[model samples]
Target: MDPEPRSAKGRRTRARLVEAGKTVFERDGFLQARITDIATEANVSHGSFYHYFDSKESLFREIAEEVEVRLVSMDDIAQDLTESAGPVDRIRAANKAYLAAYRKEAKIMRVIEEVSRYDDEVRKVRSKRDDYLAARLESAIKRLQADGLADQRIDERYAATALGGMVAKFAEMMFIGGARFDMNTAVEQLTYLWANALGLVPTADQKVPAKSATA
Candidate 1:
């Protein structure tokens, strides 16, 4: 493992190298990407690259960790919504945010997924990311059940795992697998499925606002 950069300049150089690694890895893939390419892209010396990362794989791991942070933060869309937002609206917002973030990072995500198939460490990182998301979803489902908004009969853990996997698979298919579909329609359909699965229904007094059809 490489030592942490203590100085501000060292931190900036490390961050630049990480960003450069992402660019090269997305363009040339993990097996084909080289430390020289990353160093060149970052406008840093080859020795500087070693100062931050022991190898290209180490740099790629750091990049994957950063991607996980961004993907996890996208889940906060539901929490950022107003209290009056209906279940369907919250689900839609979260799905939209997740899908959008996934799309933005699709290239790197594809590389990560490919590498995880054979690399044990990378696969562990991928599993950790999925587990974190599923745990959050489980908590949200439990809250819905407690509020009498979702089905109490459903097991929160299993429901969360299944539902979260559904959205993730859909995202992989659409963004990574090159499947074409209208973004707005995809979000609406995902929201409908998620709500129906949880048996979510708004009370008579809960007025759900209209949403734009435009993506």
Candidate 2:
């Protein structure tokens, strides 16, 4: 059956709710946020919240999915890395993007981390994210090595897997552990390892620089 005309409005309302929910989740966190708060923030009837989402946790899953999407879309970072810069620069830019996203959304991100502890659904979301990111890193690593920017000495698969793990750990420490993880430190650390691992230019001590972007 053709859907009601209100279906479009429903979709719009749902999108607005998700967007508002993201801000609220980012502000107060998913564990702490309430349906009333989201409804109030969305300026919708409290009952309407349920009409759109089964529960607050389901709403959070929607938000988490969007966040995952935003992370992967990152046109500026991916383009600057892939289209504008060489393979080594691509790695550095990608690292900076991960850290920047983590820093900007630390609270909502903490919610994801916390929820993953006991919730299988949240864990699945996280697992999917990790797998997608790992595949991307693996492909990029292979591409770089094949293109001669990376060192053939290192196993392409191993380097990609190791690099992906390092980036994930770096985000955790930097955003969650409150470490002194700045762009410079990220670049210096990754660039050094990447250059050596890939047998690229700049030898030792040369760090890859990324063009600055707004947070």
Candidate 3:
């Protein structure tokens, strides 16, 4: 790997290369992306690409790390809403935030997912992101249980893992697999399922009408 650029111009140039690499990778994929295309996209010489990154793989690893950071940060943003929201509302907000982020980065995320299948470094980064999300969900579940909102009998770890994975896979399917789903409906249904899975009791204000027996 190249040393971090110190000068302002050098840093800008390096940043451009990274951005260009992402575009090229997303366009051509990991196996097909070339340093020449990245340099051309960045408006830099082929050798300049080498001055910033050792190889395409190195640049991709950096992007993968960045994506992981953004993903984890999205989770944090959702958690920030917890203090003011009820259980269902909080879960709905989290799902909305996650799905929005996934839609925005679907192309690059698809590339990262494909690369992680064969690249150990990328796979580790992906795993680390997943673990962080699961940990946060686990903590939230425990809090709900402690507050007498969620069922105490459920194992937090298993529930967290399952619920987190469910949301993630649902996002992947809707965004990457081209499954057509309305965002509002998706968030509502996911929130409903998550809350019910944990046996969350709704607050009085959130009560819904009961279905008739004939219906």
Point to the candidate with the largest TM-score. 1
The per-prediction tally of clashing pairs is: 0, 2, 0
Q: Quote model 1's TM-score.
A: 0.90
lDDT by residue for model 2 (1-215), tens = 11122677887778778877887887787678888889889989888887788888888887787776666555668555435466556666777777777777777787778778988888888878877887877787678767767667777667767777787777777777777655666766776676666677873444455644422
Write down the lDDT of every candidate, Cα atoms only. 0.87, 0.73, 0.87
- Kindly list the per-residue Cα lDDT of model 1 for residues 97-143, writing each as its tens digit: 99999989999999998999988888888888889999999999999
Worst lDDT run of 10 residues, candidate 3, spans 206-215
Better of 2 and 3 by TM-score: 3
Off by over 4 Å in 2: 1-6, 78-84, 203-215
lDDT accuracy of residue 179 in candidate 1: 84
lDDT of 1 at 24: 98
The local distance difference test score of model 3 is: 0.87
Comparing 1 with 3 on TM-score, the higher-scoring candidate is: 1
Global fold similarity of model 3 (TM-score): 0.90
Query: How large is the C-alpha RMSD of every model relative to the true structure?
Result: 3.0, 4.5, 4.1
Report the lDDT tens digits of candidate 3 across residue range 134-192.
Answer: 99999999999999888989999999999999999999999998887778778778887
